[model samples]
Target: MFAVTVDQVGSRSDDDRVEQAIDVVSTTAAGRLVLPPERTAGDEFQFLLDDAGTLLDVVFALARSDGWSIGIGVGDVEEPVPDSTRAARGDAFVTARAAVDRAKDVPEHLALEVAPGRRLGTADVEPLVTQTVRARQRRSREGWELADLLRAGHSRTEAAELLGVTPQAVAKRWSAADLRSDDAVHAALARLLTEADTPAGADTPA
Candidate 1:
C-alpha cells in the first residue's frame, strides 16, 4: 500500500477551527483515509491508497478551487518486515510530512509531486537552522522573543501583546514547538534545557 498525505495550509490558530476545516477536506476527498493529525495542524491528513495516481489526481482536483493550498506526498514502505500494515502507515506519514515542507516553499495553487529523494532529511539541516535563526532574529528585533515571554510566565495572549504579533502567531509558535502534546514536549524541553545548561562540546552526537 502507498501512503498519500494531503496537507492544506491556512491561517488559523484555534485548534477546533483547524480540525473542522481538515475534517471537511478529508470527508470530501477520496481513498482509505487516516487523519490522526496533531491538533491545530488539521489542514493535514494522511491516507493509505492502493493507487497513487488516482489518489493524487482526486486530491489535486478537489483542492484546486478551494482557496487553499494543498500539498501531497506519496510514499511506500522502506522495507519488507513484520507488521506490514504499520510500515505502510509510517510511509504515509513520511510522505505527508514531505508534502507539507514542499507546500511551505512554494506558492498556493501549485501542485507538487513529492519524489522520495526530494523529501525532507535529504536536504541539509543547516539551511533550515539558518532560516529559523533569521525568523527568530526578526522576532527578537521587533520585540521580546517568544521564549522570553513564555519564560516570564505571560499568558498566551499577553505574550502576543508583548511580542507585537497576533495571539494566533504566538499559539502557532508554541504548537509548532510541539508543546501542545504534554508528554513529548515536556520530555523534549527538559532534555533541551539540560543540554543548554551543560558546557558546550560536553556531549556530542554520534
Candidate 2:
C-alpha cells in the first residue's frame, strides 16, 4: 500500500484552491484509492492507495496546478485503515508526514519515502518520476494547454482548432515539451510499480 500527503504551498489565504484540489482528487481518484481522501488539518489532505502504480496520476493532480507540496510513501499500513487520519497508525502514514515536511523545502514540490532498499518502484524509478513531474510543473502555458488537450483524448487537429493554432504548430509544441517521452516514462513507471507490487509467492496460489 501507499500513502500520499499533500499540503498547500504558503499561507491559507488561498485555501479555496486547496479545497478545489481536494474535490478533484475525491472525484477523480476513486479507482486507485484505497481510502477516500480527507482533509487532516488546515491546508493539508491525505489519502491511501491500493496500487503504487497510480502514484503518478495522483502526483499529476497535485503538481499540474502548481500549488502543492506532495509526498508519497510506500510501505506497510495497519490493516483496516482508520476512518480518519487521526486514528491512522503505520509506517506508511508516518513516512508520508515526514515526506510532506520535506516537500516544503523542495523546488519540485515533491518527495517520496519507501522502505529502505525496497524494490517497489525502486530508488531508480523514484528520481525518474520526480524528474518527469518537475518537467510537467515547469511547462509553459502553451505547452501545458496542449498537454491537457491531448490528455483529454482530443486529437492534435482538434487541439489546434481549439487553441487557434495550426496542427503542425500544436505538434511542434507537444514534441518540444517532451510530452511523448514523459508519457512513455509514466507508462513504464506504472508497469514497474505493478510488477514490484506482485508478491514473489503470488504464482503459488492455494
**Per-model TM against the reference:** 0.36, 0.85
lDDT of 1 by residue, 155-194 (tens): 7889888778898888777765533443343344333322
Question: What lDDT tens digits, residue by residue, belong to model 2 across residues 1-206?
Answer: 67889998875566446678877787667666777778888878888886644677877877886788988776668867777755676777887888888888988888887644344544645686678787776788899889889889998899999999998999899987888776778778776655444444354212
lDDT of 2: 0.75
| lDDT measured at residue 117 in model 1 versus the true structure, 0 to 100 | 37
After superposing candidate 1 on the true structure, give the runs of residues whose Cα lies further than 4 Å from its correct spot.
13-43, 65-67, 78-89, 109-206
- Report the Cα RMSD per candidate: 17.6, 2.9
10 residues in a row with least lDDT, candidate 1: 118-127
lDDT for 145 (candidate 2): 89
TM-score, candidate number 1: 0.36
